[model samples]
Target chain A: MTGSLTLRAGLLSCILLTAFLVVWHLATRGAGVAVEMDPEYAALMGATATQGVSAMPGPLEVGATLWRHLRDPFYVNGTNDMGVGIQIAYSIARVGIGYLLAVAVAVPVGFLIGMSPLMSRALDPFIQVMKPISPLAWMPLALYTIKDSGLSAIFVIFICSLWPMLVNTAFGVASVRKEWLNVARTLEVGPLRRAFLVILPAAAPTILTGMRISIGIAWLVIVAAEMLVGGTGIGYFVWNEWNNLSITNVITAILVIGVIGMILDQMLARLARLVTFPE
Target chain B: MTTPRFISMEGIARRYPAPGGGRTTIFEDLWLPVQRGEFVCVIGHSGCGKTTVLNILAGLDSPSEGTVIVDGQAISGPSLDRAVIFQGHALLPWRSVLGNVTFAVRSRWPDKPREWVEAQARRFIALVGLAGAERKRPAELSGGMKQRVGIARALSIEPKILLMDEPFSALDALTRGTLQDEVRRICLDTGQTTFMITHDVDEAMYLADRIVLMTNGPGACIAEIVENPLPRERDRTDLHRHPHYYTLRNHLLDFLVTRSRTFRDSPPPGYDRRHPPVVRPGAAPQPVPVPETGDTLPLAQFANRRHP
Candidate 1:
């Protein structure tokens, strides 16, 4: 039953793709009459004016552009013209460093909050207030304080990634089953050892789930943050393509962003699976 | 009497603040002594604070009022000398069977080498009949197997006293029976002093040397301590056929079903809180009339009836 369902689903996806492509092809088949004009004038008028073509690129045009980008994904053709791979790599690296920094800070602090009622209650107001503000809202403050545009982009990722993980780690640690804690208590396991041995393992799956959520948010925020603090990233690439009126390139960047985000989410999903227990 | 009681509870009471204001007592003025190598089970209805008494003995919780002295030292908190087997088989899900046992062994003897810890853990795991399943995580194991790991982990610590809170209550009947037998055999072989809280009267009878009964709570007391009349070598399959089996079973059942509630409101006349009466139901000397406060019979009357 499952196999047949999967087969039908795959067939439906292909049908949908074909239908979408057919619609795109028909929609962008420009109907305006061609006005014979000077070659230099036509060049100045851009590709859209050549034979009165529509400015919007069709699926075929987008597909060709995607193939070209794939061919030399990591090419470095000066500041404004680096390959898609390089731009994606820049975004990933920023998210990676920022997310790791968040992990380092959030986990221990979260442990403290989870383990102690005092800290949890004490910091709850700050977390509650800070968590809802958009990471992009912090972009101006980050640029002013940090001074580096690249670092500012990373700061947004860090801020965006921090809360879910911190909240999750705290919830996970605090809710560890009383029986397990009692088992450790009766064994006379010291506080530090008990934290590492009992609480850490028990809370790990929840912590990883928090991490997964944070990474997804971080990935989403990095794109917009990169567009704001434009140096070199997938988000910047999309904005740059839009400026150049290269609709095909922008669409390609969108696809790449989606794929990379999925990969990032999948990596954390695998890590979550590793720590999750059957019970 | 010179060698201090192996374990002693002196006027221990547990209370929680009520929603309105005043405290609600779970149990109060509780006093009991456990000699070395004794297997004692506390049997009571759900609300009678039987677990509270066991938790106090394990030092997992503080008594609102009294002190628990184990092997001479007054317990302020949990100690390495006491190990608990929890009802939920609280094995660390991430750890394997061997890993769970080794974790306890290492906690008890922090100075021991890794190999020594593993060896000690393996010995206890084997003792619980889980020798070949060492690498299996708690999730992969059956309920009975998980509980066996719990028992193995408790015994691995080699504590002065074992505290079990319905350790086999989660298992099926057959599994519980087998685990009970295994626990009894291990406890007997090691001469381990244990305090367990259970609702199963038959389980208490099969495993406990003395069954401590608590009246129903909100303000509970030790109703009486019933000495197990069956021999140490009693078997589960033929346990019912023992001459004193039904008498002892009926006594515990009667207390749980009827007496536990009534006894809390109206304790026997001349009932001493400091020294609750110990009765060996099938072996009571005679039908002694209820006595007034000063006319109470000495504990020696029932003490002489117990088998060595």
Candidate 2:
């Protein structure tokens, strides 16, 4: 039954994709009536002015461009021109570094807050105040202080990724079953061992959930951060493509960004499943 | 006469600040002592603070106004000498049965080699009849099986005292009976000093050498300690066939149903907090002094048949 359901879902997806492509093909098939115009002006007027083709690239055009990029994804020609793979790699690198740094800082701090009521109460106000602010809101301050666009983008990813992990870790740790804690106490497990063996394992699934959320937010924020900083990354690639009037590349970058985000989310999801217990 | 008891709770009291003001005393001036190998059960209704008493004994909790001396030394915190089997069967769900037991064994003896630790764990797993299920996680196991892992984990530590907080209360009747039998057998064989809290009268009768009865709270206290008259070797199947079975059963039931409530208003003629009266129901018949007599009067008459 599950297999048939999956097969039906796949078949529906294919039908949707086919219908979308056919509509796109039909919409972009016609051109405006040929109009008398000077050659030089016609060249500058572009397709929208000289012809009736939609400004939106047809499915075929986007697919061809996608195929080309995939074929040679990692090539680099100049400062302004690089392969699609290179752009994605840059975005991933920034997100990875920032996200990892956030993990290193947030998890320990979260544990402290979770384990100690004093720290939890003391840190709660600061966290509450900072958590809702947009990641891009920090871009100006980061760029001003860091004086480096790439590093500023990384800092924004770090900030955006911090809260979900920190809050989840703290909540998970604080709410660990009292019975389990009591078990640890009766066993006379020491502070360090108890934290590592009991508390860490118990809170791991929650912590991983936080990580998944952080990675998603980090992926989203990195794009906007890159656009603002105007350097490397898929966000810059999209903006650069837009400036060059290449909607195909922009669409391609969007698709790639989505796929990467899903992959990152799934990676953390798998990790979460690994740590989850039946009880 | 001068020798310290195996486990002595001296003047222990538990209180929490009341909502409006002052304090609500759950129990006060509680005192009890156990011999080296005795199995003791504390029986009380909900809100009677029986589990709190067990927690204090385990050193997972502290009494407001007293100390617990275990084996000639004061216990300030949870010690390896005491292990608790939590009511929820608090096995680390992430760990397999073996891993759970090994965790406790390793904690109890950190310097022991890995093989030695595992061997000790496996031995206890076998003792609890969970040897083949060592690789199974707590979630993969049935309720009874999960509790078996809990038992294995607690026993693997080989503590000086085994503390249980209604460990079998969560299981079905058949499972509870079987687990009770297993626990009874293990305790008897090892002579491991055990203290448990339960509301089940039969459980107290079957396992406890002496059952400590508590009155209802905001100020609960040990009303009496009933000594078990049945031989320790008695079987669970034909337990009722024993001569003293109904006498013991009826006495506990009577105390729980009626005497537990009114005992606080008017304790017997001579009641002591430090040393609650120890009664043996089957031994003799003794009338307890009551200020008011009615239908509830006869139950109290046979219930506290003090043996001293």
Candidate 3:
């Protein structure tokens, strides 16, 4: 039954894609109206000078541009003309470093807060005030203090990713089953061993859930951060293409951003599954 | 002969502050003792603080007013010397049956090699009749199987006292009976000191050498300690046919059904708080012989005839 359902769903997706392509082709197809103008002026008009073609590129045009980008994805023609792969690679690296730094700081702090009610209460007000502010809101301060736009962008990703993970780890560690803690106590397991053996395993699934959330938010914030900082990232590629009025390149960058975001989310999803246990 | 007290609770009282002003006493001025290698069960209704007493003995909880001395040392907190079998089984769901048992074994003997820990855990698992289920997680095991894992884990620790709080109360009747039999056999063979709390009178009779009965609470106390009259080798199937079975069963039933509620208001004359009276209900002036054939006398009539 599931196999048949999957086949039908695939068929429907094919039909939808075909319909969308057909509509796009028809809309962008230029009317053949011959305008009586001087040869020099007509040459300056570029695609508009053709008998009846619209200036807007159709799906066919976008597909050709996407094919060219894929063919030479890592070409570095100049500072502003790097290939799509290089741009995406730069974005991914920034997100990776920022997210790892967040995990290093958040998890241990989260553990301290979760394990102690006094710490949880004391830090709660600070976390509440800091959590809801946008990562972009910190851009001016980050740029001024760090004096490096690239590092500031990475710092934004870190700040955006930290709260979900910290909150989740704290909540998970705090709510570990009382009976399991009692078992450790009765066994006379020392505090450090008990944390690793009993509390860690018991709270693992929750901690992973928090990490998954943080990774997704980090990926999302990295794009906007890169656009603001404007060095070498998929988000900057889209903005640069828009400035050049290359609509096809802008559309291609959007598609690449979506695919990479999905892959990043899927990676974290698999990690979450690895830590989950049947209860 | 005076038996040396392997464990003793001196003037233990557990109380919680009431909602408005004063404290609510769950139980107060309670004293009890267990000789080495003895099986004792505390029987009482809900709210009687039977579990509190057991927790105090296990060093998992502190009494508001007294100390629990085990092997001549006052216990301040949980120790490796006492192992508890929780009512919920409380097996770490992520751990396999052998893993759960080995965790305790490793905790008790951190210097032991991996193979030695595995061997020790395997022995206890096999003893609990869970030999073939060593790799199964708690989620994969049945309720009875999970509880067997709990038993194996507790036993592998080699505690000086095994503290159980209604360990079999969650199982079905058949499973409870089988586990009880397993427990009785293991305790008898090893002469392990055990203190258990249960509401099941039949379970108390089948396993305990002495059953401690508590009156109902807000301030419960040890009402009496009744010595089990049946031989240690008594069979569960024919337990009813034993000469003093009905007398002992009815005495426990009467206390739970009626006396536990009123014992607090009207204390028995000259009842000592520190040394609760030990009663042998079936030991009347005239001895009753073991029934040879099918004796069909009703339980109430049999109890009255012997005790009266």
Candidate 4:
């Protein structure tokens, strides 16, 4: 019965998504914006030829266009491009690179800052002053200095992701118990072992919490960053659809983007669960 | 298990830097001639520098005034040779009970294989009566269980001296009783030389072969040292039934409580003279015993734990 209920919930979710798409289809199909009649679209072609009417393609026409391109690809990621799959792969790649870089540097630096009072106090002023500025604010400088749109986007993601990790690392390190340190001393664990075995594990959950927040913020920034640069990311897809005055395409991209972001956040949440309280 | 002198701390005195700068003498010119297998408990009021004194003996801290020579060697920084079981267990929250014990062993004897270490730790987990719960973390264990882990960790090293700083004081009454009995049994069985500090007079009276009573703080000294006349195998549950138990408890109680009245009422020597009543109202400048001198009698001079 429990298994059947889970199946029912799964089906219900698909049904709800379909219903939402249908409502979206109805609302945006013939709504105010004018789509020039295209001869290539079969339904629009019939209306254009029979009634001499300039009938733009509707929701179904766009779906048919999307369906045609779904599998027929131009190898964007290893073997596939010019399709929705490749578009997703491209965005995922950017998020992965940018987020990985952010993590590699931030975690160590954060730990260092956290472990030492002098470092935390020394660097605190800079972090506080920099964290509040909009991640978008770095775009202009990144574009000019970095000399590449993709690199600029990555740099923004890096900037957005770093603050959480660094702050969290500092906090996690600072909160390790003095008694625990005493245990380390008594055991005669060297400084390196003390940090890795005792201090790191003790502070791991908090550090992961910081990473989760950092990644979520990074995911949020990618969309805005892609919108700024006219590229082949999911964010660019939204902007491109808006230009054609197709609200349905815009809404579809929004849904896809939201779903992808949720997946990314969940991945991080699972990672957080794996490195947790020690037994 | 019978052995020679395990721990010998001779002429130990500890002084702390007075808040501003100069040293405030806490203890001075002391002598201790502990045998290899004897159990000594120090009973003192708070700030008697009980913890400080224990730390010095444990090699966690150095004596600002005198030296602690242990097992024929002058004590240095923390070592496995002197195992300290601190109050509150001091178990790492990250490790299981077994892991905590094994870690202490592995660290001291780094060359020992993991399998051998595991076997050693397993033996002790069963010995402490936490056989099945070895995998559970410190947080999952009761306070008493955690302290058992602490004891197990201390014993794992097979150190010459076992130093405890009020190991059972933090526990609840029942748990405290259980641990006290377990500790007593372990010490007796192993014949490990032990030094413990506690505020509980009964705990001191019940556990120690001899109880060392410390005077009140701010340079408090040892007022008295009473040897427990009871047998080592005496039942802990019925300890208070011993006629000397009440008598000893009363002596300690009177020293801690009733004696304070005398100190409060008595004026400091030479308070009325030199300084006028206007200078310092009703309070007379009391005669604080300026510590005469703190000199450590060489630990080698002791009956045991002496080197040629």
Candidate 5:
């Protein structure tokens, strides 16, 4: 039943895409009415003024630009110009490093908070205050303190990724069934062994859910952080294309960003499924 | 008495602070002893703190007042020597039947090789009649099967005393009967000392060697301890056919329905916390001392009257 549902959904998506592309093609088709003008002024004015072509790039233009970028994705043209793949790679690398660093800090600290009532109460105020702050709001301080644009962007990613996972891990650990802990106690399982074998396994699904949310937030924040830092990332690429007024390139970057974000979310979702137990 | 009993609770009491100020006692000055290989089931109404007593015995929860002594040693906390089969079955849902059993086996014998631990677990699993379902997770199993896994896990550790908190109460009647039969056979065959808590009188009569009755709570105490009159080798299906079955069952029912509520307020004359009256409900009536206090009467008089 699910398989057939998925197939039908896929077909519907294709139909929607086709209809969108056809509408875009017709809407952007150049107006046949010609304006007589000075050749020199008309050359400066370009296609929109001379041929009455729509300024917004049509689906065909975006597709052609996407294919071109895909054909030579990793080429670096200088300090200012780089291929789409390199920009995507830089963004992923930053998110990966910062997110991994967040994981290292969040999970263990979350465990400590979850396990100890004193620590949980002590840290709760700080988490509550910091959780609502936007990741980009920290960019100014990060750049000031870290004194490096690239590192500042990573710091933002790390901060944005930290809260969801930390809160989730703590919640998960704190809420493990009392009966399971009683089982461990009765078995005389040592504190460390109990934490690893029983508590960790029991809390893993919830922790992974936190991680899934963190990764998505990290992906989102990295784009804005890269835009602020003016560095080599997909977010920077989009900003740069917008500055050059190349609507085709900007649309292509948006599509790439979306696809990469989806892939990252899917990977974490699969990981969450692996740890989730039925009961 | 000669060997200091295999398990003993000495004046253990559990209490929680009430909303206004003073503490509300669940049960207090509770004392009980079990000889080795004895199967004792505590029967009580919902608020009587039977589970709290079982938890105290298991060392999962410490009594607010006194200590529990097992095999000459006072229990400091939960120990490997006492294994609890929880009411909810409490199987680690992520683990398979074999894994759950193996977890306990490994805990009991940490240095044992993987093969040895798994083999020991498999033996207990089969002993609980779950041999072929080793790979099934708790979520995949029926309620009865999950509880069977719990029994297997508890038994695998070979604890000196097995503690079960209404292990079969959640199961359907048919499954409860089958599991009870299997557990009775397993406990009897292995000579495992067990302390169980349940509200089911028939279950107490069928499985327990002695059924300890507790009054309704707010300061519950053991009202009486009725010795089961059925033979040790009795079968579940034919349990009702026994001559003493109805007598034993009715006495327990009567205590729970009426006496349990009034027990704390008006305990029988000569009722002792240290030694509650031990009555064999189906036994012939015997002469007993009359009460000195006009307001109090001996509870045993009613038990004897009910049967005779």
Candidate 6:
């Protein structure tokens, strides 16, 4: 039942996406008339009239583009373009590193903050100050400090992803029921053991939520970082396509970036549910 | 001294800081003594520090004024020898019904095989009528079942003294009765000392060998302790049918309902309990000293009062 329900929901979303795209094209199709179906506009769209297609390639075109990107990939990737898969892998790898680092550092720090009032009060202002800064703003500073573009991107992702997780971890640990702590004390669980087996597992849901939020921010920041760093990533690919006047590739990259982000977020959501099933 | 009383709270006084700036004394000069294999219920109105007293016994909190000695030793913190059942079932949401009880047993007895721990947990689940619910988590169970799991978990260790803080106050009448019966039977079977805090008048009259009633909060003192006149083995359904049930119930209700309201410093409506009237007052006065547990009331005490 769960599988079928999810499948039905997925199909429904696709249908809704088609309807929305149709409406979007209809609103903009008349733009072709305004520009007289100019050949310049069709540089990547392949002369809309010649292909017997609308200026904006219908749902079928996007679907074909998506399928080709999934199966054959490169030959269909773009006009003078890097493969969409490579662009996606670049961003995912940076996010993976930055997210892992964030978890490694944030979790321990958060546990201490939650366990000790002095630590929480002391570190709270620093966390509050750093969490809200824009990732691109950090890119220039990181680039100057690290003197390496790739590492700077990683640093940017790390900074962007750190706080949600840290704050959530602290909150989760703080909210662990007192009775459970009493049980741990009764069993003679030491401070470290209590943090590991009792408090962490008990607060796993909240911590995972923080992780989810952090990963999302990390993914978003990597895009901004790649654009600023001017490197080979999904963000760079979109910028490169725009500069080369390949509008189809740009649109395709936009869709791919969104879909990949959705998948990553969904994976985190699934992990959260698995840990917090409450049974 | 005095066989250590199994569990003794000698002049325990807990005073938590009041809001803003003031010390709120919930309990002061409270003397609680429990013998092994006896069941005692601490009955009081809200904020009487019954739970505070229970926490001190469980070693989760300390008394500001006195010591809580358990098994002839001072208690510094929680230990396996004493188990506590709070009002809400605190079962870990991530674990299964069997897992909840098994977690306690496993932590305490790491060397025990998995099968043994699981078997013991399953037995407790069945004892709480959750045989088919071994894999179900706390969320999947009803409120009563969750509390039963709490009870089963407490009993699983076979702790020497079980501390219950209104464990059944939230349940409806039917489930409450069934679980109360189960609790009585289990205590009878194990002979573990129990100290429970509750507000139910009939419960205090029914289960406890001794019911310690406390005054109002903000200096909640142990006003009186009533010993149940009936035997522990008496049929619960027919318990109130005994001639003395109404009398005992009314006497306890006076302390909990009437005395509590009057203790708030409000003016009384022409009632004086400090000195019993020579002639019968408007309301028929209850007998002063109800007979203690495991003892018969003298004919002289009952002679002054009628069953009605």
Task: Enumerate clash totals for all models, in the order shown.
Answer: 0, 1, 2, 9, 0, 0
Instruction: Assign candidate 6 its CAPRI class.
Output: acceptable
Report, in order, each candidate's fnat: 0.95, 1.00, 0.91, 0.53, 0.95, 0.60
Ranking by DockQ: 5, 2, 1, 3, 4, 6
Q: What's model 3's overall lDDT?
A: 0.89
Interface RMSD values for all candidates: 1.0, 0.9, 0.8, 2.6, 0.6, 2.0
Give me the TM-scores of chain B across the candidates.
Answer: 0.91, 0.91, 0.91, 0.82, 0.91, 0.83
Q: Superposing every Cα of model 4 onto the true structure, what RMSD results?
A: 8.0
Please, what are the lDDT tens digits per residue for candidate 4 over residues B37-121? 8899987778877888888887677876656677667777877777889887878776888889998888788899999998898
Q: Give the poorly placed runs of model 2, Cα more than 4 Å off.
A: A1-3, A31-51, B2-4, B285-308
DockQ of 5: 0.80
Residue A147, model 3: lDDT of 97
Kindly give the stretch of ten consecutive residues in candidate 5 chain A with the minimal lDDT sum: A29-38
Give per-residue CA lDDT, model 6, range A96-140, as digits (tens). Answer: 998899899999989889988899999989988987778778877
Per-model TM-score on C-alpha atoms: 0.92, 0.93, 0.92, 0.79, 0.94, 0.83
User: Once superposed on the true structure, which residue ranges of model 4 sit more than 4 Å away at CA?
Assistant: A1-81, B1-33, B61-65, B260-308
On TM-score, the leading prediction is 5
Badly placed stretches (over 4 Å) of model 3 are A1-8, A31-56, B285-308
Q: Write the per-residue lDDT of candidate 4 for residues A1-279, one digit (tens) a residue.
A: 567987999999999978976875665454332355554664645554544433444557667756654556344543212455566676778878888898899889988998888998999899999999899999999999999999898889989988998898889988987777777777777888888888898888888999899888988888889889767777776777688776656655665678788888898789788768643
lDDT of 1 by residue, B145-187 (tens): 9999989998888888999999888899999989999999999
Task: Give the higher-TM-score candidate: 2 or 4.
Answer: 2
A41-83: candidate 1 lDDT, tens digit per residue: 9889866667656788888899999999999999997999999
Model 2 chain B weakest 10-residue run by lDDT = B293-302
